[model samples]
Target: MLFAIRFTDHQSEYNVRKHYLNYHLDWLKQKRGVVLAAGSLREKHNDQPVGALWVVKAEHEEEALSIFSDDPFWVHGLRASVEVLSWSLAFEDMLKD
Candidate 1:
C-alpha cells in the first residue's frame, strides 16, 4: 500500500524545523526503500518551507503511521498537524520505478 503523509509546521517553528532537518533527513535515508518520494512544502511567494510531504510504501495504515511517528520532526514536535491518506496512483512518470 501507498500512503501520503503531509505535515504542517507549527507557526513560528522555522528554527525548530531547521534544527532537526538533518536528523529528519537521516531518518528518512534509513528508510529509503519505503520512502518513495519526499520533500519540503514551500510557500509560493517567498518559497519559505511550511511543511513536508512524503509518499511511503507500507503494509497498512498503522505501519504508515508508525513511520510518521518515528520521524524526528514528529518526535520533536515541529509539526502543527499531520494528515495521512492512502494513495492510488493514476499515472506516474518519474516514480513509476
Candidate 2:
C-alpha cells in the first residue's frame, strides 16, 4: 500500500532539524526501496524548511508509521505533528507503475 506521511516541525526547531539532517538522510537512504518520494516542505518567502513529506510503500499503516517513528527527526522531537494517510494516485505515472 502507499502511504503519505506529513510531518510538521516544532516551532523554532530549525537548528535541531539541521543538526540531525545527515542522520535523517542516512536513515532515508537505508529505506530507499520503501521510500517512494521524500523531501522537506519549505516555508513561504524565506524558503526555510518547515516540515517534510514522504510517500512510501508498505504492507500496512502500522509499518508506515513505524518508519516515521524511527526517523532521527521524529525521534529527537523535531516534529510538532504528524499525519500518515493511505494514498492512491488518481493519475497513472511511470513511477507509480
Candidate 3:
C-alpha cells in the first residue's frame, strides 16, 4: 500500500534537515519500497521547504514507520510531529513501468 508521511520539524529544527540531507537521500535510495515523489513542501507564498511529502509502498504501517524511525532527523528528535496515512493513486499513468 502507498503511505503518505507528513512530518513537522521541531522549533527551528529544520537545520537538522539540511545537515542530514545526503544521508537521508542515500537511505531512501537503498529502500526499494519507497518512492520519494516530493521532498520539499514549500510555503504558499515564498519558496521555502517547511516539511516533506513522500510516498511509500510497504506491507504494513509498521514497516513504513520503520523507515522514519531510522531517519537521522527522527533519531535526533528533530521531528516534532509526524502523520502517516494510506494513500491511493487515482490517476498515475506516468508511474507505470
Candidate 4:
C-alpha cells in the first residue's frame, strides 16, 4: 500500500534542523526505494521549510511510519509531529510499478 506521511517541524528547532540536514539527506537517500516521493513544505511568505511530506510504499501504516524513526530530523527532535494516511493515487499511470 501507499502511505502519505506528513512531518511537522518543531517551530523552535531551526538550529537543530540546520545542524543535522546532511544526516537527514543521507537518510532520505537510503530510503529512496520506499519513499516514492518526498519534499519539504515551506511557508507561503518565505521559502523556509516548515515541514515535510512523503508518498511512501509500504506494506502497512506502521511500516510506512516506522521508517522515520531513523531519520535525523526525527531522532534529533526537529520533528514535532507525524501524520500518516493511506493514499489512493488518482493518476495511477503517473507512477511506474
Q: RMSD per prediction, one decimal?
A: 1.8, 1.7, 2.2, 1.3
Please rank every candidate by lDDT, starting with the best: 4, 2, 1, 3
Give the range where candidate 4 is weakest over 10 consecutive residues by summed lDDT.
Answer: 40-49
lDDT string, candidate 2, 1-97, tens digits: 8999999998688888889999999999988999989998987856888898999999999999888778899889899998999998886573553
Q: Judged by TM-score relative to the true structure, which candidate is superior, 1 or 2?
A: 2
Using TM-score as the measure, name the better of candidate 1 and candidate 3.
1
lDDT of 4 by residue, 7-93 (tens): 999889999888999898889999989998888899775767899999999999989979899898999899999999999989878
The regions of model 4 sitting more than 4 angstroms off are none
Q: How close is candidate 1 to the true structure, as a TM-score?
A: 0.87
Over 4 Å off, model 2: none
What are the lDDT scores of the predictions, listed in order?
0.86, 0.88, 0.74, 0.90
Pick by TM-score: 3 or 4, better one = 4
Model 3: per-residue lDDT, tens digit, 34-90?
664647576775755667777777788988788778877678766787888998888
Number of clashes recorded per candidate: 0, 0, 0, 0
Query: Candidate 2 has what TM-score?
Result: 0.88
Q: Note the residue pairs that clash in candidate 1.
A: none
Model 4 deviation from the true structure expressed as Cα RMSD, one decimal place: 1.3
TM-score of 3: 0.79
lDDT of 2: 0.88
